[model samples]
Target: MNLPNKLTLMRVLLIPVFLVFFLIPGIPCHYLLAMIVFIAASITDALDGHLARKHNLVTNFGKFLDPLADKVLVMTALACFVDNQMIGVIPFLIIMMREFMVSGLRLVAANSGTVIAAGFWGKLKTAFTMVTIIAILVYLSFSGDFNSFSLACADTIDRVCGWILTGLVWISAGLTVISGWIYLRGYWKFIDPEA
Candidate 1:
């Protein structure tokens, strides 16, 4: 109910609006619209955390919901990309696998009365993932233009974007895997094989 928590909720609320803009057909500049919505949500993601720490408004609810909102927002975009064939399935699967591993590790830590904060690598992965999504949306927005020049170089642009996006996906996936491993290893003692 605090400002930071409200911002987190706002980020979550914007996800459906992003989907509406992203998934619906025939909307003028739909990709651009979705990108704007996504960017707005991303800003809130940053703002909430900053405000939470700056003003000492951090709460258990904020801690729980902020990361959950981030994961949901990111995974939803990745799912849309895969469903639309904008990206390959492997990167999506890899990111999702990392999320599952991290979430399970968090559960183990929580049960042991320990809280695991996001590490540097995890933050880097999230930042890179958001930037990649924005880049792809920017590409899509321009690609939808049917200007003569664009039409003439459509294949070339598509090919270039394809390679760039793939590289971005793999880079993000690599970070996710590294961060997941770090989190798991750091808290391995909390996870008991006997349990």
Candidate 2:
């Protein structure tokens, strides 16, 4: 395998490690560790693509596995967030469906000897969604029991955090929907029998 493909596989390998950190409650600073692992995996995703494109090492395997790795990592992280009540189910569903649909379409295109690379909208959607997830993780990592604070102060901070999370979720959801539509619409010929 090429370097880029190796990097992509490394990302897939890291997911279970991140999961262990995220799901294990007794581990000290587990959320922070999870965030760090997640960020590392995200870095690998970017690095692999850059290396593949720059060195003319892009292959069918890389094209197929890279996006799959991305979806697996991001979706797993989002699922972790949902389980912890850091995000709502509706927004998660929206994002998850987009990933799955795009992935499915990509697979179909690949089978037809076409490579459906990511567009601007899809890249932006990924950026926003990753940032939102990371931000939520950071917040949850450092947060303390609000009950220990003065009620008024706790209420104020709670409202502020709520607004931040809500804003992030909505913005990410919007990007997800727009990107998903653009991808499917752009490649309708491959997706639609009548096209």
Q: Could you say which candidate leads in TM-score?
A: 1
Worst 10 residues of 1 by lDDT: 143-152
Error of 1 at 77 (Å): 0.3
Whole-model lDDT values for every prediction: 0.90, 0.88
How many angstroms is residue 70 displaced in model 1 relative to the true structure, after the best TM-score fit?
Answer: 0.3
Error of 1 at 54 (Å): 0.7
The digit string of per-residue lDDT tens for model 1 on 78-157 reads 99899899889998999999998888888778887888899899999999999999988887777763332367777887
Those runs of model 2 whose alpha carbons end farther than 4 Å from true positions after fitting are 144-152
Q: Name the 10 consecutive residues with the lowest summed lDDT in model 2.
A: 143-152
lDDT of 1 at 189: 84
RMSD for each model, in Å, please?
1.6, 2.2
* N/CA/C clash count, model 1: 0
lDDT of 2 at 20: 99
Global fold similarity of model 2 (TM-score):
0.92
